[model samples]
Target: MIDLMGYADRVWTGQEDLRPYFSGALREDGLLPVADGVWMWAATGNVYVFRTAGGLLLFDTGDRHTSRALHTAVRAVTQDPLHIAVFSHGHVDHVLGMDPFDQEAAERGLPRPEVIAHRHVPRRFERYVLTAGYNSAVNGRQFRAPGLKWPTVYRQPDTLYDQQLDLREADTQVLLRHGMGETDDATMAWLPDRRILCCGDFYAWNAPNAGNPQKVQRFVAEWSQALHWMAGLGAELLLPGHGVPIAGAERIRQTLLSSAALLDHLQQSVLELMNGGLTLDEVLHRVRVPAEMLSKPYLRPTYDEPEFIVRNLWRRYGGWYDGDPAALRPAPRAELAAEVAELAGGPQALARRALLLAKDGDLRLAGHLAEFAALAAAPGSAEHAEAHQARAQVMESLAADSPSFMAKSIYGWAASQSQAASRGEEPGKEEAGWAP
Candidate 1:
C-alpha cells in the first residue's frame, strides 16, 4: 500500500502536488489505515471504517460503481459485522454501497446494520426519484458523459436525526451533526476520543462545491458557518469524502478555517453587490476571491469555481431577475441571434470575428459570438457548418482556459457538439476527451 500519511505530509508541506489526490490517482484500491483502528477505502467517495470493540462503524459508502469492490476491500481487512452505517448525505455517490455489507450480515446471521442520516435525507431521495431524468441529463452534461443514467433507487436510512445523534459502540463514540453544505442532509461524524472527523463533501480538497451550476441551490452562508464550526473541533485527523486524509490538528484547523474564509468572503461580496442593486452579470464580473486564497493547494478551483459560488449566493439572496429587464422575459435565443447576425452583416461575419477574438485571447466574448453565429445560420447550410466550426474552436479554447473540472466538462461537451455540427454529424453522439 502507498504510504498515504507520508504522501499527505508531503502534500501538506508543499513537497507534492494535490492534483493526484483530487483526481483519485493517488488512491489505493484496498483499504488504507487512517488511525489506530480506522481504515479508509477511497473511491469517487470515501468509505471510512472504524473497528470498535462492539463491531464496526462506517461513515459514508462508496458510489454504485465501486460498491461491490468497496465491500470486498473492507472484508479483506476485517470480517467484523458492520455495527452502524452512517449516510453523510443523500447524494447517490455516498449512499449506495451497502448492498454487499447487507448480504454479508445475512450470510453471517448478523442483524442488519442500522443506517442513520439527517431527517432531510429521505426528502432528498424522494426528489431524486421524482426528477431522475432531469438529474441524469444535467449530470451527463456536467460530467461530459452523454446519456448517463441517474439512479432512482436509494437505500433509506433506518434511523433519522434532525440536529444531532450520538452512536456508541464499545469505547468508540461518534457524534453526528447535521450541517447544510453541499447538501441539506449533510452529516459530519466526529470521533471525540480519537479527534477524527469524517466530513462529507463539505471539505473536499477543492474549492467548496457550494456553487455547482447544473445542480440545485447550495447554501453558501450555512456551509461557511459549518466549516467554522468544524474548525473549532480541534480535529487531529480529517477524513474527507473525496480526497486524501489530512493529519495534524493545526493543519486541519487551518484548512477548515481557510475554506470557511473563502466561502464567507464570496458570500459577503455577492450579498454586498446584490444589495447595491447590481445585476447578476455585474456581480459575477466584479466580485472575485483573492488570488492567494485560490493559490492554496486545498483551496484550488479543481471542481467548482468561485464565479459559480458567487452566482449561487446571488440566487440564494436575490430573485432570478438578475436586474436585467431584457432577460426577465427574453425572446427566443435563435431570434436574438438572427437579429445580431443581421447587424453584424451575416453569420459568416460573426463567425470570422469570433475566431479573431478567440485568437486574441478573448474566449469568453468569442464563445458568445460563435454560438450566436451558429444559431443564426441556416441549418445544414455551408454557412452553418462554418459557424459551427468556429464555435467548436472557441469552445475548445474556453475549455482549455478553465481550471475547474465542472467548467471544463461543460465547455468540452459544448465543443464536441459544435464539432459534430460542423462535420454534419449528430451532436452529443461523441463524448468529450475528458468523459469517463
Candidate 2:
C-alpha cells in the first residue's frame, strides 16, 4: 500500500519544538485574577474558579495530570469549599481535574462538589471509554506525543441540562447555555451581574478548530451562531477556556464579531463552491479566507488549517464522496504505486525525481512521490532506504518552515519516521500556552 503505517509511526513521537498557542500547555502554571472573584489557572487547559456566597464555582477542571496544580492554585486564592463545578466540554483536557477536589471533600467530611454539564456529556464520556484505545492512538499521532494517554475515569455530571440552566450561588447568577461548537457537550457560562462570559473552547484566540482533520465532525454553523449570540450579549469581560482573560466590552465585541465573520466567511465560501458543482479539490484550491481576516492575530491558522476545514465542510454538506470518480473503488495503493514506479524506471529513478522536486521547493508533491517510491520498492532494499532518506529531508524541511504548531508536529513526526525507515527500522503503526 501507499503505506501510512510508516507515516503514522513517525507521527507518534515527542514534539521537538515549543511555541505559544491558545492551549495553556506552554504558559507558566499560575492563577491570574480575571475579575474581582473569578480567577483562571493556566495549565494544559484553563480552570476558572469563581467565589460565590455558597462556595466556589469552577468553569472547567484541568486535565488529569494537572489535578494537584489546579487544586493548589485555587486554594491559594480562596479556601472556600467547591460547591459547584462545570465541564466546558467532554474532551479529556477539560473534564478530569476533579479527583483532588473529591479527595479534599472526603478528608474534610464534606460532600463533593456538584458537577454540571450539558446532557450529552455522559454520552461523550461513554464514547471515550468505548474508543479509548483508538482515541489514544490517534491522539498520539495527532499531537506527535506517544506518552499522552486518554483518561478513562470521568466524573459524570450530577446536573445535566438540555438547553439552559440558571443557578444561584448566593446573589451571583450563573447561566449555563448549551452550544454545539468544538464538542457536542459544550456549555458556556454567562455571569449576568459581572457581564463576563466563559466561552469554553469556542474562541481560544486561534482560528476556530471547526475542521480538525483527525477529530470528529465539528459544528460549524452552530458554532458561528453561538458566537453571534455571545457577541450580542455585550460581555465586558471574556474568559475563554484556554486563553487569557479579555476585558473591555468594545474589545470583546470586536473579537467575537471578527471570529464569527471568519467562520461565516469560510463556511459560506465552501458551500457556494460546492453548490457551483466544483469538486472538493477544486473548491479547496479556489476558496480563500479573506486576506484581511486572515491577517488578524486571532484568525491565523495555527491549529486547524483552513485546508482541513475545507475538507470538513465538504464532508458536512456533500458527504465523504469527493466527486472524483477515480477515488471510488480505487485500486490498492500498493498496486498503483508499483505501476507508477515501474513507469518512472523503478524506485531508484523515482527517488531521484522526488529529490529534484524537493530541491525545487515542491516538498508537498515530493512527499507523495517519495512515499510511492519507498512503498513500491521491496522492503529493506537500497532503493527503499534512499527514497525514505530523501523523504525524511523533505518532511523535516516542511516542518521547520511551517507556522502552525499542529503542522510542525505532524511533519516533524513524518520526518522522524522516514529517517527510522532509512535505518532499516520496521515500518509500523503509531502516536501549548494560554492567553485569553
Candidate 3:
C-alpha cells in the first residue's frame, strides 16, 4: 500500500510540473489582418475571420466573453453578413460565442450564418442536451455539472463535411480538412492562396491537450499525421484555435514537426512496450520521454499530462476496460473502500501513517492514504473522521507546493473537499475542471 500510493503521488507530482509556464500573456481585442482576403483576432481563444468576396467567414469563435468583441471586430471590418462560421471542434472555448453572429445577421434580416462542423459535432450538441450531468463532468469548466448551462437552441450544422470540404471564393480556396485532434470532430481550415492554415485546435501552441483524461480517446496517430503533412505545406502563417499565431514557413513547419515528434515519441515508446508483451503498469513505470524531446516549448505538458497520453495510447490499442481483473467486476466504490480500510489495520492506523508522511514532506502520498481511509469511513467511525482531517492537511500542503495554476486549482479543490468530509459535511461539489 505504501509503495502503490507513493507511485501515484510521484505521478501526480509530475502532473503538477507538466503544465507549461504561463508567459503572463496580456489579452487583446480580436484584430489582425493578413493577406488580401484574410484577417485574424486573438481574444480569449484565437479566431481567424476571413474576408471573402461573398461574405464574412469566421474560422472559429472564441468563448462566451469574446462574442461582443468578435462582433465589434467583424463589424469594423465589414458590415457583410457572416456567410459561414466554422467550429474547430466542440470545445467550450471555441463554440459558445457564435450566438453574436446569429444575432447580428438576424437584426439586419440576413440569413443566419451556416454553422459548419464535423459530423460528430452535431452529436455533441445532441449529447449536451441529453446527458447534461455527464457532459458537465467531462467539460470540467466552472459552468459545468451543477450549474451547467450549455448553449441552447443549437442550430445543427447546415453543412457537414465527412473528410474534407473546399470553400472556394473569388480567387481564394479554403480547404476544411477533417482530423479529430482535441475532439473526435475537429476540423482544420486551410487557405491555399494565402498559404495560411487556420488549424483549429489541431495545432495549439500550448502543450497538446489531446490526452484530456475526462474526454474521449484522441486520434493521436491521425493528429500527428495531419501535422506532419501540414508541416510540409510551406504555409507562411499558422493560425491556431488557442494561443498566438506563428509566422514564417520554416519556423511553422518545424513547430508542426516538433509537435508531431512529441506525440510520435510517446506513441512509439508505448508501441515498443506493447509489442514487447509488457503489462500496462510495467509500461507505465518505464514510459519516459527523452529530455531533448520534452524540452520543446510546444511539447510542454501545460494542459494535458503525459501519463494520460500513455494511458490513452494503451486504451487505443487495448480495450474499453483496463487490464486489471479486479476492475473488471469491481466492488462498488464504497465496498472496496471499506474492505481496503479493514485490511489496512483500520482507518486510525491509516490516519497516523498519513500524518507521519505529511510531516515527512510526502504530502502527495499522504493525501492518497487519507483518501482511501476517509472514503471507507462509516458515519460513526472515529477512524474515518481522523483520516479525513489528516487528508485535508496533507492536500493543503500539496496544493501549496504545486508549481502550476491548474495544479494548484486541482489540489486546492481536493483539499477543500477533504476538509468538508472530515466534519461529515457535503462539500457543495461544483463540477468544472475536476478530474475526480
Candidates by lDDT, descending order: 1, 2, 3
What digit string (tens of lDDT, one per residue) describes model 2 on residues 20-133?
324444334456665687777776777888898889999999888888888887787779999989999998888899999989999999998999999999999999889887
- What pairs collide in candidate 3? 19-302, 20-302, 140-432, 140-433
Residue 146, candidate 3: how far off, in angstroms? 6.6
lDDT of 1: 0.88
Deviation from native of the Cα of residue 352 in model 1, angstroms = 0.8
- In model 1, the clashing pairs are none
Q: Which candidate leads the pack in TM-score?
A: 1
**Worst ten in a row by lDDT for model 1:** 427-436
Ranking by TM-score: 1, 2, 3
lDDT of 1 at 28: 56
| Candidate 1 deviation (Cα RMSD) | 2.6
Tell me how many clashing residue pairs each candidate has: 0, 11, 4
Q: Using lDDT, give the best candidate's number.
A: 1
Candidate 2, position 352, lDDT:
84
Ten contiguous residues with the weakest lDDT in model 2: 1-10
Error of 3 at 208 (Å): 1.6
Candidate 3: C-alpha RMSD after superposition: 8.1
